[model samples]
Target: MTPERREEPGRRKALAFTVLVHAGLIAALFLGVQWKRSQPDVVEVELWSSRPTPAMQPAPPPPPPEPEVKPEPKPEPKVEPPPPATPEIAIKEDKKKPEPKKPEPKPEPKPEPKKPEPKPEPKKPEPKPEAKTQPAPDFSEMLKRESSERTARTNAASAQQLANAARAESELRAAADKKGMQDYAAKIRGKVRGNIVLPQSIQGNPEAVFEVIQLPSGEVLSVTLKRSSGNPGLDAAIERAILKSSPLPKPDNPALYQRTLEIRYRPFEE
Candidate 1:
């Protein structure tokens, strides 16, 4: 079938074209009427429908696929043989044969330890709790009390010893009177009281520390020097000092003193 052509479209030109085509058609119709007197009959035209064209064909199918192939198997790994054992040998000798010796392994050296030197055995210290709640007590008062008690005990003992010494002195005086040395001792005492003192280092006499006895009426008897102080000068000086204090001071102890006097001066008395 033939394709329909598109009309050139525009408003002002189509309107002018339509007006011209109508005028021409009207003039042609007038001419046709005039020509109709000279001619015969005229015919009309009719339009019919048209058929469409056939469709195009497609391409043919491709060839078939090829077959697949399988791969070959792999070979196995090989193994090694074990070592042969040593054979035993026979000997025909009188002497014994030695066996093979095995090698000895060297020992590893031991490490020197940085030991803490036993850390002084860690002196098992006291518990922390006991150290905390329980505080140390003051011993000052207790020490002072003990000191006072000790001093009091020492003073009492010293007083008792002094009393004992006084009693002993009394007994000694009585004994001297019985032995008739009291008056002599008294006169010697008066003479020695302030006049003489023995050497400080003198030693060795408890008795017979006397020399001569002089009566109160003024008579010098045999003078004996005993218990020498190991020093002739001191002994002589003591004698001189004693003689210089002669006619001994009268004794205030009347019962202990007498008319007959014994003079005694020992450089080593005490």
Candidate 2:
């Protein structure tokens, strides 16, 4: 019995060791499955699209297509129907001749009468009447007073002639001055017109006014636009033109020369 008991104890110990080993293996396998379930799964995928996003450096938007310029269509010429031909008609008329009248005779010239010779007159007797005044009226004094009166009349006539001559001279000078002023103004206008370069798109007679200052030598000192023509380009062009005409036309008469000029610029005919 002691021998059997010892064998039984050894078998039980072996079986117990085998059972503990199998239980440890089962515990390790369950922990590995739990760890695997807790861990996160990582997946990688690639995305593609036909169009590029802003984020992606989109190729510089194909250079914006250049705008095409079309030639302006030319206007067709108008055709007018010719007038119908007119038929010619001929007409004949007869002319009448008148008879001539007789001419009248001219009167004859009469002869002039001659003057008669003078006859001698009878001699008459002279009467001696010596009626001498107490004092011969002062004849010398009378002659002197008459001479003074004549001198005064001659002086007055001379004064009147001088006044008439002065008035005529003044009138002639004024007329000449006015003509000179007109001519000077015309010359200035012409000079400005010659230098002006009009814009192609301008329409209507839009006016641009300027106040200009100049030197006596016809040099343009300054040009200030007083009014605009509404078209900035046109106004700018004219302003440039005025400056380009640096030395303007000088007046024929220096007295007609002016320092300032108010010029009105018109695009069309002056």
Candidates in order, TM-scores: namely 0.24, 0.44
C-alpha local distance difference test of each model: 0.36, 0.48
- Model 2: residues with Cα > 4 Å off, grouped in runs: 1-148
Residue 153 C-alpha lDDT in model 2:
55
The TM-score of candidate 2 is: 0.44
lDDT of 1: 0.36
Best model number under lDDT: 2
C-alpha RMSD between model 2 and the true structure: 43.3
Model 2 agreement with the true structure over 129-209: per-residue lDDT tens digits: 112332545564456446655655554555455555555655565556546656766666666666666667777767666
lDDT of 1 by residue, 1-270 (tens): 223233434656789999999999999989777733322111110000000001001001110110110011011001211100000000100000110100011111111111222221221222333356355443644454466556556655665565556556655654443344334444445455456544444445322223445565334443445334346656665666556566655444444343333233443324
Model 1 misplacement above 4 A: 1-184, 197-210, 213-216, 219-222, 249-270
As a whole number from 0 to 100, the lDDT of residue 92 in candidate 1 is: 6
Question: Which residue pairs overlap in candidate 2's backbone?
Answer: none
